[model samples]
Target: MTVASITDLDVTDHYAEALHEVIEAKAEHRAPTPTTGEEKTAAPVVDLMAALEKSVADARERRGESSGGSEATVHEMPAKPKKKTAAKKATAKKTAAKKTTRRKTA
Candidate 1:
């Protein structure tokens, strides 16, 4: 007879086994996994919407506008691409190639 605390109920061997059994049973009864083709088709729309919403929220926050929700306003700087000079680009390419070679050999 082991005394179990509330937290112990979640962490003990008996509870863990029970949880695993429940998860396995649920997984077995669930529908088949969606095909990669279906995922690829739907993923872009979701990603685009998410990116747009994030951009709007970021723009609002930077201008000190409040969101109607309980979430804190997160100010984000607009992403600017680095202006690469010929010298910098050559140095970067050399370093990147060196890194790849070292990784492959290691």
Candidate 2:
């Protein structure tokens, strides 16, 4: 058996037709009739992140763990002196000591 081409297939856009009918009904201030036999019902919108967080919280609760409410402590590192500055201070101290020794010897 040969397969039918897409051009030969009869396609009907039920959604577009339904939407157009609804728009026209609203303009005429009348309730739109059901375009298809089945009535469309909207599913509840869910927040996936919130749901996952709640699931994790529930699991933690079942395991006898508390929902973490503590704020994280951030540690700030002290700034270090530059290598050149440290080296200069060391050389200055060494020269000062040498000068004192030379004066004592003299």
Candidate 3:
């Protein structure tokens, strides 16, 4: 099998560019236009921390959980592995302690 080249790829590039511009212009026309001549302003910067806190509370409220201020606890989002491992270790220690106490009393 033989592969063929179109000699000048620039012609194809120009057509592609023109077609993209036409499609974008048509799409802009289809969208609703604002009546005011004033330019649309970008949205205000958001405090991500505050927004996340509110979101968590809202979600907890929907789940029928208490959204108390003093009792509010934020769990770490990223998995450290250390936390779960530590929890397992702590549980094991407690069980071991109980077994040792039972053995000593018996």
Candidate 4:
């Protein structure tokens, strides 16, 4: 099969022109109009985080209980959570401890 470039394809023909016009009309008809109101607010970041955490915990619990043999157990197991780099965890712990100290002082 030959790959034709834009220059190689003839767009001057009546069929091509008619097809282009039809496509333009269809696109204009289907185009979404801009809305003139406040956009809907998304759920809070903390709510999304909580949902993701709950899903991970549920998956872990499900994998722990299965009595089926190796293949079934392997299929049922969720993908492992991405391991946090030790440096990242240490930085997070330090920030959290600082916050706790601030709360105590306050």
Candidate 5:
């Protein structure tokens, strides 16, 4: 009675049942049940180089750069101020502790 959306993976009831079973098994602290033959098939292999190239291309296009990597320039981040030394921090803590000790002793 249910119609699958175009965006839905072709998996149907098996996917839902498998997901539910896995969730239950995980909740019970039990090992996952073995997948059926249909589920045993390997997922499509990814081309890392191609994917990276595509991502870079898309990013460059968004930033108004052409496909050529070298011509693309990135904006520089503003420099942050350096933190005070550990010695300064320790001295501040020691000063506070000395004041606390004097108050307690008095």
Candidate 6:
């Protein structure tokens, strides 16, 4: 489609038109007209926590685990301290000797 001028553009806003009609009806002290077609209903509310628990129970049952049986426990171990290598030991000794043998400057 080609437009010769800015006025040729299709700028009809259905929402604005409907709002204007409602305002006019209110000014005349009459009820605003209801929109035609089937009315929409809100979806049923869900219990998320209960649904998740049931799902987990179903999965456990499928996996041959009893609902009231013992559950697996996890224990975390403390990480072992790293041992100093021979090169690191030598570097430490050198650093200590340098600090001890340094002369006081005036």
Reference-based lDDT, residue 93, model 3: 39
RMSD of 5: 12.5
CA lDDT of each prediction against the hidden true structure: 0.66, 0.79, 0.67, 0.62, 0.78, 0.82
Model 2 clashes, total count: 0
Per-residue alpha-carbon lDDT of candidate 1 for residues 1-106, written as tens digits (9 for 90 to 100): 3675655665546556666767777889964433233234444446888798889889888989885555767899999999987665543445444344344564
Collision count for each candidate, in order: 0, 0, 0, 0, 0, 0
**Deviation of model 4 at 106, angstroms:** 99
- The window of 10 residues in a row where model 2 has the poorest summed lDDT is 93-102
Instruction: Please give, for residues 4-72, the per-residue lDDT of candidate 2 as tens digits.
Output: 676577878888988999999999999999644766799999999999989988988899988795445
> Tens digits of per-residue lDDT for model 6 on 1-106?
5567756887877788789989999999999897574579989999999999899899999999888856779889999999987664543445444445678899
- What is candidate 4's lDDT per residue for 1-106, written digit by digit as tens? 3566766877556566656767777888864433355579997667888798678667766889543322433446788899887665543444434344344563
Q: Is candidate 4 or 5 superior in lDDT?
A: 5
Q: Estimate each model's TM-score.
A: 0.22, 0.30, 0.28, 0.19, 0.30, 0.39
Compare candidates 5 and 6 on lDDT and give the better one: 6
- State residue 4's C-alpha deviation in candidate 4, in Å: 36
Candidate 2 lDDT for residue 67 = 77
Q: List the candidate 2 regions with Cα displacement exceeding 4 Å.
A: 1-4, 38-106
Q: Clashes in model 2: which pairs?
A: none
User: Deviation in angstroms for 91 in model 1?
Assistant: 82
lDDT of 2 at 38: 67
Alpha-carbon shift of residue 93 in model 4 (angstroms): 59
Question: Alpha-carbon error at 67 in model 6, in Å?
Answer: 1.0
